[model samples]
Target chain A: MQQTKQRLLTGNKALAEAIRLEMERDPNVFVMGEDVGVYGGIFGATEGLFQKFGPERVIDTPISETAFIGAAIGAAAEGMRPIVELMFVDFFGVCMDQIYNHMAKIPYMSGGRVKLPMVLMTAVGGGYSDAAQHSQTLYATFAHLPGMKVVAPSTPYDLKGMMISAIRDDNPVVFMFHKTLQGLGWMDQLDASIGHVPEEAYTVPLGKANIVREGTDITIVGIQMTVHQALEAAKRLEQQGIQAEVIDLRSLVPLDKETIIQSVKKTHRLLVVDEDYLSYGMTAEIAAIAAEHCLYDLEAPVKRIAVPDVPIPYSRPLEQFVLPNADKIFREAIQLVNE
Target chain B: MAISKDHLLWMYETMYKIRCYEDKMAEAYAEGKSPVFNIGAGPVPGEMHLATGQEPAAAGMCVHLKKEDTVTAPHRPHHHAIAKGVDLNRMTAEIFGKATGLGKGKGGHMHLFDPDVKFSCGGIVGAGIPHALGAALAAKKRGTDWVAVAFIGEGAANQGAFHESLNMAALWKLPLIVVIENNQYGISVPKTASTAVPSNDVRAAAYGIKGYYVKDNDPIDMYNVSKEAVERARTGQGPSIIEIETYRYLGHFQGDPEVYRDKNEVTLLRQKDPIIRLRNYLLNECGVTEETIAQLENKATFEVDQAYAFARESDYPKPEEALEDVFV
Candidate 1:
């Protein structure tokens, strides 16, 4: 693969660039959402495309999530690749039928005869205290459902590359981006979110995990913003003579279990950090994987940190207490290593 | 139907209370959120959807309802909750995440549930339409005159639930009234860009139901139109749709940049403020005394102030309380 000149880009701009390049490359590709047009996007995922492609290509639908999301699946079935944004991932309740029942099942329900090639991109994760409805990173909820390819990118480079790859893929892909990583002026952003994204389009295939850090004592697995939190925790753990390896599980549905298994095998300990709920979520899934594959290799029971099975609270104090942060991760990592 | 003196007083008092509460809420929402407006920084953290300019829709329609009737409101729900007679202290405490809240701090401002007054609201755009329909169905089944009202924004009228619920209500002849508070915008997207028809009342025809449109933001107009609709529902005719051209004085959420709308738009809308119009009508047409008007204003201020004080002094729920209420 030929690499192009790299420039500093936020996670949102990288995503927008990927969509722009894909739309330019393929005439069948288009974008639609609540505020995707004129307002760019509430999270800036579809910025500048509305002006470049106009309303026809970058359409703005009503607050009818079921209608628009279902329309995306229908449009995809007819050969047009629609990259529809559902604004917030929390709003999936109204349109989950169209997603799980239709969008996910169409390809298999038709026995591969009808290919519903589309991307359902939405803003996920909760940190700035937008309350329960506005703030949620429902990764496991979507991943638990089969048929959709769920990918949540942490940095600009991976977001750009994975977005391009998701567009070119033949299956329905769920692209989840965190609001804090979008690098918008209003919200406080993480330093790790801004990275060198290649000017030209590239493909980072889905279902592959990136080993962001290497260690020997334990493996810390995370996705989206949790990956950054895991890395921060790993850095703090290094001072205490504990070397923790970090794995960014970019894809959830087609999970990179091999990478996780190999890393856990070498380390003999594992800690899964997730922003989603603790019960029946990504942590449980990863813990089950380790228990199934390397039951003997695990020196201690698989420790996991996540939102404590509760709706994202609105008040700052309560919200901070429930959210999975670096301090919580570090404390949990220490406990895992000691155990 | 003629607007009686008592009805006029009730409308004015309700609208005044809503305005006062919203004004105080806006001030409280701005606390700890200055210089840089971090949404989570304030004492009242999270999104605050203030019903600043859309009080008439609630006052006019709710003035006709009883305690047994159910009212389901949208995200911007303070006006409807107040008009529907939800306890101000508990509702305010809920917004402040206090244990004394309606849902014991578990449900925030958008998810206010007060079974006492049979009032509840949801954060989702059109999610409440079906809930109102179900309530209306139960009322019809129980052989009662209890009606259900769902107050939704113009943008929500385009939702699938809105259409589905309307069709079901019309088919079953349920006692439901759908009020479309056409406040022009759903966040940044204007109603013109979102809805297929100019007014949502026209969509009511598709369900074979009577539809009424309120062009002005006048409470009298809203009240007169709602009277017929309410009568039709209570008499077991069917459901009705009322699309009121209201106003949203503030941004979609507090601290919104609002680049999509013109800066002067809110100012222009405020010139013909519904509260002021209603007050003038009461004083001039109804020959109400200025002292009586002053008394109502003082009462509204006093009640709103008490509610705010109660909310501030109340303790937040124990952190462990979040684990509860997921089930029974």
Candidate 2:
């Protein structure tokens, strides 16, 4: 295999690059959805794909979510691995019946008779002024589905690795990508870190949570943009001699419980930060699971720093007020360890 | 055109079975013997949607398909599931949320999966359309002489997936028969308002395929129309969408008041009830004696009764095993 290197780009662009790579590797792979080709995806996640792959492969579809998703299902059942993009996570209301009830459950429902190898990629999280109709951090809702693996990444490395893993995964997987990660500018740093990945086709294994920063005082769990906030918060706390271990839970459904539990056991305290609401969200679910499993190892009660339960307002200050940032996560972490 | 005596007798028999089975469910539900939220020892908290007035759609369509063929169903699916040769005892136990039911009591009324009997559930509205395509693809690939029927309602036709699935089924030359049971409603929403088009199958030319229509008041007409579509599909003529214009006589769910429509409309459609029409056909065309038909009805009723008895004797699932069958 030859070595392939590329210039630095945005996180969304990097993902678009990865999608192109996967398509190049296998003829069976196709990207289908609205505006994926000529429109270059809703946010340019699929720029330059139509010319590279053409309509037969990088096809654009009508505004029919279920039909296109269903076509993806039929294609997968007939042996093609189709990567279909649902424009926004919130548009999943009409498509939920197909994704949640059938796509997620059919493989198991058929007793392994059908292997649905499909990717339901979507743009999730907040910060964009798409209003309530466009923006809602809904990872928790899909995470509740049994047969689907929920992938939430906060960096380019995680994005590349998780996308490869998701594309290679046999079951139906929802890759929730946020608009915030493109700010990291980590694509250029890819070669500096993991070096260039092998040109030959491969897959990153599922269910492995990475410890982005290691410490011994308190364990911090963050997802997507929250991971970035946690890192900044950890840096600020390190000055005060407080070591916070950051665990990036890349996948949510087949959640890496052991990694989080083991990290908590080491730190004796835990703080969860998320962009979703405080009640019944991933933060709460993570806290509950940890409390039930690692209650005795805790020196202090687990804490969750989340956006208050409300619709994300459009104004910048109000949005900041509703979102959890470095100051909030830092304040929460310091309180848990200091108290 | 009225149904023949032979087909009319079969429809009457099927409608009788559906009625008997539903009555049994109502009794079970009333006696605290239902699944969901009650003793759940007898109550499983899951809502069950009974297919009462939708008998003609199931009976008429199933008439065209052989025992070896397939039918995909929706949430309101008990009639289709049973009509496809799924055991009543297992189905009853499922409705009661017992361990012995199909899907091991995981997918109550909406999901009645039977791979062996050629009946699988897409469960979600408009979702099963693709599974039908995939199965039809498999049948075509394996060179098997069978047609896959994707049974959906007027409401499901409004769904984008319905159009997408039909387009692909038409495009790939797959042997899939898409039967649209225009039950006039999807839950509380009426079809006339929900759908942008007057008809669903009429859009078949967009996918480069032929569309069909049937005013399915009589089971015989439904069977005949379905027969042509089934024959076309089995012969590798690609897919055909047969829109059966009918109405669901009951509430969308077990407790729907159907406040969405006028009662006068219901009364008008009921004048040509499939069961009565079939009975009339049997008397005029089949030249069969009333005693034999009565015996068949009695047998079906007895079978449904035994199914209830078997389901009642079945045990509840252990709490520890609650999460089983979620995966294969």
Candidate 3:
């Protein structure tokens, strides 16, 4: 076995390391976004890259998402692995035509002739009350669209590994990182945000779910920030004589149904926790998976805790009330385990 | 061509109204958001993009528009909306997320849609340009003099939608006017670093359309420039591009920690506030009295105050009401 050095690192640092490693290995790999160069990314995803690679490889672009994102697509088509940042996932509205119509559909439209290898990374999630415009985890929105491989890792290890895998992947990938979990000084971070990340470049393959905690009573599934919330809920549930298994669904498109189904088979219950809008969201997707395959295995009906379909209100109290929290997940888990 | 005295006074009053309204909004937006500055804690929550120093761009161009014309604005839309004659109380109520709002609290400040005044705006940078194109296309098809105006920032000019819309507008000869408000910055990146061209008006030549460039964020300059463009569009002479050099007095949004820009930049820009410049021009060049200016100022302040009071008194929509407007 190869020895790997481990050190505590935030999700942002881990991501930056992965990109730096990949760019060094591959000549085609480059980074571009609004502040990704000199600013090192507002969320620190591309931190320290500009200093190392210079402006040629790490480019700072204008606030034109359509132009640069579309340009990235063009560059990718012509044999370049471009990792473009959308700044914030909420800012996709202006350039959605290029995203949904062109970038997402080009491969299929070209009928296997053109290979568009690119990674579109963006910051998502909201706990800091960034209001409606800046604060949103539109995971389901991207996952719903075909031709895009969507991934949102909850840990630094997963972030670094998955980012490496994404940079090398030939297909288009949408990598989303929760701003709060990036371990930035300005934002509040959970203990789970930082973890022992390996120094060597290793890839955590896409379309796999990580069982963060093992339990027997019920299975709790979550992604990004909600994964930590689920873990917290599981810990609290353990004191009540309930064993709650926590599954981190790092990939959204190639959803790891087998792991979730197996967990439900052992636990006999399922609860989906999400930060995205409730209706037609990840919760519904996970719940549907259980209903489809493990319906008979589940002891009780599946439960879901998520932000109600409101466009995240600006008032703190209202936003808190709508958003899914550890307490909400715990309450739902307790009731599900009881039943 | 000389601007009429009545038109000059109208522009001044409108500029003053926009300034007063923005001042009131800034004050109200700070309530419950202090010490720590939690963005969602305030009364007028969400992203607030105040057009504090952009009154000249709005008032100058909008002074020529009639009731039938459509005006599409970018995220920082209050100045354009006010200039286009949107109801102040309803607009305020909308920003406050009250049931009596423009969209019954469904659309916030950035997503304001006041069809009564043929005005609408969205949070997206260059998203409104195509909408203005469609409106202008409709006017041309209907054989009407109703031109559509799309007010976008300097940053938005770099968007693919802006370029596409310009090409389509020129090719079809639609009665459209695209105003590029060169606010020197897109959040933090300056125009010099972002834009490839020294002047955006030069881009109009590529589309074979008339181009007008306004300097120093001057209201009268903007008015003089837009006058010929407006007449050209109204007479079915296709579209025109008007690029005005302007400055943003506030941050991109409320609560934005603007570390990217020099702190002293705003103070230097404020030294040449467009409203004050227009007021001085009226006083010195046009022989306008101080009492008249004071009356307009008082009127604008009173109207803005009444709107704020109305917004404060209005009730918020029911929590379940969020589901109502998604489909409609």
Evaluated with TM-score, which candidate comes out highest?
A: 2
State residue B28's C-alpha deviation in candidate 2, in Å: 5.8
Tens digits of lDDT, candidate 2, A101-192: 67888665553555678889998877656566676778788887788888887665666767877887788888888865644342223222
Comparing 1 and 3 on lDDT, the stronger one: 1
lDDT of 2 by residue, B1-328 (tens): 4445566567678877987887677556556543443433444344556666677778877876776576787777778877777878887777767788766666676776665677766556778887777567556645777888888887877676777777767766888878788787778777778887777778677777767777755577777777778788888888888787776766666545678788898788778777777777777778877887798789889999998888778997687666554433
The TM-score obtained by chain A of candidate 3 when compared with the true chain A: 0.98
Tens-place lDDT per residue, model 3, A177-258, is 9898999988885788899998899999999999999999999999988889888888899899898899999999778999
DockQ for the candidate 1 complex? 0.01
- The 10-residue segment with the lowest total lDDT in model 1 chain A: A105-114
Per-residue accuracy of model 1 over B91-160 as CA lDDT, tens digit each: 9998988888887776678877776787767677776776677567557655789898999999988888
Worst 10 residues of 1 chain B by lDDT: B319-328
* Leading candidate by DockQ: 2
What iRMS does model 2 reach?
A: 3.7
Q: Model 2 clash tally?
A: 9
Docking class of 1: incorrect
lDDT of 3 by residue, B45-145 (tens): 88899999988999999999998888888889999999999999989998998988887776678866666677777666886776677567557655788
